[model samples]
Target: MNKQKQLSEVTELWKTNKKQYVKKSSFSAYTLLIENHVLPTFGKAFHVEETDVQDFVFRKLESGLSHKTIKDILIVLKMILKFGAKNKWFEYTPFDIQFPTEREKHSLEVLTKSDQKKIMNHIQEHFTFRNLGVYICLSAGMRIGEVCALTWEDVDTDRGVISVSRTIQRIYVIENGIRKTELILDTPKTKNSIREIPISKDLLRLLKPFKKIVNPSFFVLTNDARPTEPRTYRSYYKNLMKELHMPDLKFHGLRHSFATRCIESNCDYKTVSVLLGHSNISTTLNLYVHPNMEQKKKAIEQMFKALR
Candidate 1:
């Protein structure tokens, strides 16, 4: 019988073979999860049974990880085990492991029309360092992290467009028993996510002034010339929403607001999906394609006129 290899060896094989498909940051996350969590728990097992996986998941969830997080961990585990199975390190495939699918019931939270205007009004006049960032999120439909991580090279004022090639996320990294925050620059979450989104002429005019005002290499949105962490900005967003007397919403709610407005303006779901960098049109439809009562009524009237 062939000798079994350590977990690290298996991961290295995946990384080497999967380079074109896997982004560096994703590979890094998988590596970190395996080394810090999965490997330490199952390293010596040489072959993890399906029952072992079920127990690990139960313990992880009980330790307070959210369902989404546990699901992500499971994704890594499955990838590794399947790879191991192909390599013949295990006696049999570990296909019995499964994740419980719970319906995601939290309704998609979006900003009310009045709140959208009020927030825009507040930022337009206030014109702080974050003004450009806020404008991009509201007008360009860029996520807060994507806008914060953008650079001068990505912005083409002449073309009235912004190219989204990369994004930054803050993650917790544990080293030698201590945890610390690290900034990871990753490829956009999906292939379709890599796209060029058109910007309004008015938005371009607003940004032109900031070009000369802020450092070019640094992000368009930052006080100290670094990627602005989303967590800290969410608190600021909460305060702004409170001052506007708006319904409480997270920073991401702005992106949702953008998609909502586009649909209301008769933009097709596919167009909105492309603008938002969704992996596919189906995701956009699933998340934001519900027509409001007024729109439904209008649609029916238009249909009658067409039939007549």
Candidate 2:
């Protein structure tokens, strides 16, 4: 059969499988990979060989995709191949793929106690939308996307809780030389991400005054009545810190500060993990559980004292 025939057959099978099980956003991302990258290279590779997959990966690497993004693309491709195989569309597979020995995301970078205090003081007094975003992130340990996606209705002043259920993303899709913008609102990354974080009672009191000024139907941190963009927040916060003569940190560093404060205050690992909406305890441990010499020395000293 010709390349067009093979592409059509695979595409139809993929369309059916996508409809059956995958989330709309997930399936859309997969379809984008197939259309943009995979089809351009492998459209002619009938029953794609393993070398075809390797060459495609290398070509993408040369095109300057990050290791993580490339890895995710490969995962999507693997899913497509598996779907094709399960439905008996292809007797052979394309992916005998392996990854580079690349480093994962940087370990959580948090602030010291004094830095937290400095930032908090500035945000509380010289407030802007960026400060509001920072305050919510620090106090609630909210992800940046969740913070951006939040509507004012999600805050319960009576209960003093912030509900984190939705995430916002800006996606650009290339279709027939037109780049379309898709502003998507979807559930959080994991089941654990759908949680309520209790805000500090003082902050609840502070927010009560703003309640009178806030638009009930709009997103909380928006400059006007639209959803607040994260890049703008990051830029604004950078300027805010400089104006206040404080050290620079990303908007997410506030979240790291929250988790660190909880861990230092003798909160258990599981409690900290849940409060931070981490899917697993290992994430908590990896961030905050490294033992120090001071802690170890105290432990050994206490052991000897107990024996005496």
Alpha-carbon RMSD, candidate 2: 4.0
Give the per-residue Cα lDDT of candidate 1 at 287.
Answer: 87
Expressed as tens digits, the lDDT of each residue in 1-308 for candidate 2 is: 22233544676577666767855566667677777777777665447778877877788877878776777777766766666666666545555687566666565667777877777777788777657888788788898889988887888887888889998876555556686767778897689999998989757866877776777778888745688666666787788777767666777788888887887678899989998889999988987786545567988999999999
Q: Where does candidate 1 stray beyond 4 Å? A: 5-21, 35-44, 54-67, 94-104, 171-180, 212-215, 223-225, 292-308
**The 10-residue segment with the lowest total lDDT in model 1:** 90-99
> Each prediction's Cα lDDT score?
0.75, 0.75
Report residue 112 deviation for candidate 2 (angstroms): 2.4
Cα lDDT tens digits for candidate 1, 1-308: 55676655666576567656866567667767776677778766667677887888788877867777767777887787677668876444545655566565657678778777777777778887666676678887888778767887677877888998888887655556686767887777788878898978767877777666556677666745566777766677777677778887777888998999999888978899999999888989988888766688999999999999
Which 10 consecutive positions of candidate 2 have the poorest summed lDDT? 1-10
Q: Which candidate leads the pack in TM-score?
A: 2
Compute the lDDT for candidate 1.
0.75
